[model samples]
Target: MLGHQLLWPVVAIVVMLVIDVIAVPSFLDLRVQDGHLYGNPVDIVRNSAPVMLVALGMTLVIATRGIDLSVGAVAAIAAAVACTRIVESADEGAASAAILACTTALAACVLLGVWNGFLVSVVGIQPIIATLVLMVAGRGLAMLVTDGQITTPSNDAFSGLATGFVLGLPIAFLIALGMVVLTAVLTRRTALGMLIEAVGINPDASRLAGVRARTITWTVYVFAAVCAGMAGLIIAANTNSVNANSLGLWIELDAILAVVIGGTALTGGRFSLAGTVVGALLISTLVRTIPSIGIPSEANYLFKAFVVILVCLLQSPRARAALRVRGRRAASSKAVAA
Candidate 1:
């Protein structure tokens, strides 16, 4: 059942790779230097780490019939807070400073998540509207935290999160992989996954069935926020800097797209973690392939949009049925002519 759910995305990613190989002869080339791997595939995964992390959380939120528009803002705020904390630390160069900065950023995200959860589950505001409030104001909040300035904090330990490698793989990718694994274990090995699905499928029914719907909903929101916070840290660490206005800008869209492409229905209920991972990889590969194939950078979004639409259509049962009907009609016409 899992394999069937994931087939489309897995096939899509493999197709993208084949395209990459055709467009760039060296696309598959990999080498080891100084105990670290280097290659386009590695780079694609490394660059995708942040989006992958954000998408992991988005998967759960979407599974619960909730959308978190504020994730990008929350991520920006996390990066801003972390960078500002590092700059303000008495010893910004120390590893301890990095630890403190990370802790502070994630803690702030928790509060933001709680705020979102309260508005949606407690206040009874629609999920979209509740998150939109934060989406619009969270960046301003981030700006205020950074004193309306870009923060570039020099911290080797902090930068290592993005730039460093472990066991011949990028640290950032490893971190994302770990999160995916952890989330899978939590959701699959326990009752949490079923509870989440129950709430998403029908909140009132789940509540009557002895499931804590509100709590489950609230928990997923908080987890989503923390995941965004971690993604923020990775993005900021990549450059050792944070720009309140631009950090994590529009990333929510990418995460949402990834979830959709991963075979997760927008209406909620069933979700595939493995499919989400492949979807993220496919998006990242498309981004890389566009430039490699010499498509103008300005029209990148156009190409991506086209591909996304095509994938969604392909995923639709009605669309597939339409295609099959057309094919049969054409065959009948040919047989009549003969």
Candidate 2:
């Protein structure tokens, strides 16, 4: 079990670091000429920010033994709402477009989260089906928000959230870090996290013990939506433009991959936030190292798939059981021969 906890992400990190170290050969002889890191780490950090946020939520959702297929759609819808408000604000001159964009996105996210919570908890809809409704319609709503036109906000304050940096780090990175700390605090520092775990491990038992399962599930969805909102804001700020159709596209997959690769189980029984963080870093590093070695972008998907396969391969209960059986068989043969 300890081996399972330690191996995959460590291997991934070591491999990535080695590739990055050898990223440029002797002929290339590339070294840092500027005060910055040897590589342009901003893009990787920025792009991975959203995925990390989503995965953090996914870690909770998966812990509940529920899957949220609508996070990508939620992100798109949130961005659409933010951009729509930005465009409207620009026309009316009532407020800065950036402020309006973020506010609207966050508000919409909270409402949508409540909606998801309602369906999944109160209405008893299955998690997948409940979220699927939003998933299918969210992009269309996003198109409606902008009248199918892309929006670019001129406001610097809101854009600064994505673009501005502090103390030599991207602002988005700080935001992601803050959220991670909050998550850790919520789960590890308080009973909130314990309740979530108990509910995830066994809902009926948790309820029998006087825990409110419905409330727990609802809060989880809301939390997931907030994360999605943050992700949307980060992406929108980074680009300074919002394309409803393409913005935050398919990011849900990355989040799930991160959550799973970090050693969190898909079944609602186990979670490890630290593992998820490492998984996110491993993914970003993998993507960054790929092009450095002249590998095609298409290979990245394959590479991630392979890593996920390994995560499942080495840690699966069946694999451990098989190993145990093999060990026992060898012991039995030795004892009989003796």
Candidate 3:
């Protein structure tokens, strides 16, 4: 069962990798320079780190049959807040200022998460509608923080959060991997996973059974926000600047696609962090592969949409069954002719 669930995403990733290699023969090449890893594969993972982090939290939120449309906006807001602080600091290079800026941005994200939780769990707003509120307003808030301008801060310590390397691997990738592992351990190692699934499967039943559905729902939103915030920090560090409007644009869509491709049902129930990671990597690879494969800029999105649809269809049970029936029929006809 597990293998079947993972089959399509794995296949998609392999197919994409093959395509990438075909398009750019050096796509698979890897080497060490100054004790740091460098390659297309490494770049894919490094670039995908932000989306992977967001998808990790999105996995839990989706497990509760909820969605966070505001993750991108929240990420932008985090970047805005952090960069603004760093830029406005008397000593931009000060480690203390960088730390304080990051800390403040993360704290704000937590509060934003709490707001989403309150709307969904306490006020009984639809998750989509509740998060949508922020999706629209959060960017404006981000712009406000940046004074409606792109804020660039020159701080080596802050930039290192994304660009620095540890043990020859990208620090961003390491941070994302750590978050994935921690999330898996927290959810699966405790009773939390089961309770979350129960609530997702049947909130009323879970409530009746003494599983605090509201609390689980609320917690997931907060976690999602924090994850987005972390991703925002990495993104800001990557560019050493924050463009409030475009910083996290469309990232929410990528995160959702990652969650969907990871084999988690939108209807909610069980979830897999490993699968989500693969999905994120797949999306990241596709983003890089499209241009390298000679797809026109104008038609890029169309090509991507077609590939996504094909993958989703391949993963569908009915589609698989239909294909199997056709294969069996073809085999029978061949045998009879022989």
TM-scores of all candidate predictions against the true structure:
0.95, 0.87, 0.97
The whole-model lDDT of each prediction reads: 0.91, 0.79, 0.92
On residues 1-338, what C-alpha lDDT tens digit does candidate 2 reach at each position?
Answer: 44567576768667666776686643224244333322345656655788889899889988887888888888888877776676667353334656666777888888988998899989999999999898888888888987888887666776777767676567887888889999998899898888888888999999999999999999899989889888987788777778888887888888887888788878786698887777777777777777777888878788768866876676666886788889999999999999
lDDT of 3 at 216: 96
lDDT of predicted model 2:
0.79
Ranking by TM-score: 3, 1, 2
Model 2 regions more than 4 Å off: 1-4, 25-38, 90-96, 317-338
What are the root-mean-square deviations of the candidates from the true structure over C-alphas? 1.9, 3.8, 1.3
Candidate 1 residue 213 Cα shift, in angstroms, is 0.7
**Which residue runs of candidate 1 sit more than 4 Å off their true CA positions?**
1-3, 327-338
User: In each prediction, how many residue pairs overlap at the backbone (N, C-alpha, C within less than 3 A)?
Assistant: 0, 1, 0
The candidate that achieves the highest lDDT relative to the unseen native structure = 3
| Best candidate, TM-score | 3
Q: Determine the C-alpha RMSD for candidate 3 after optimal superposition of all C-alphas.
A: 1.3
Candidate 3 residue lDDT tens string, 82-177: 999998899999999999999999999999999999999999999999999999999999989998998999999999889888999999999999
Q: After superposition, how far is residue 238 of candidate 3 from its true place, in Å?
A: 1.1
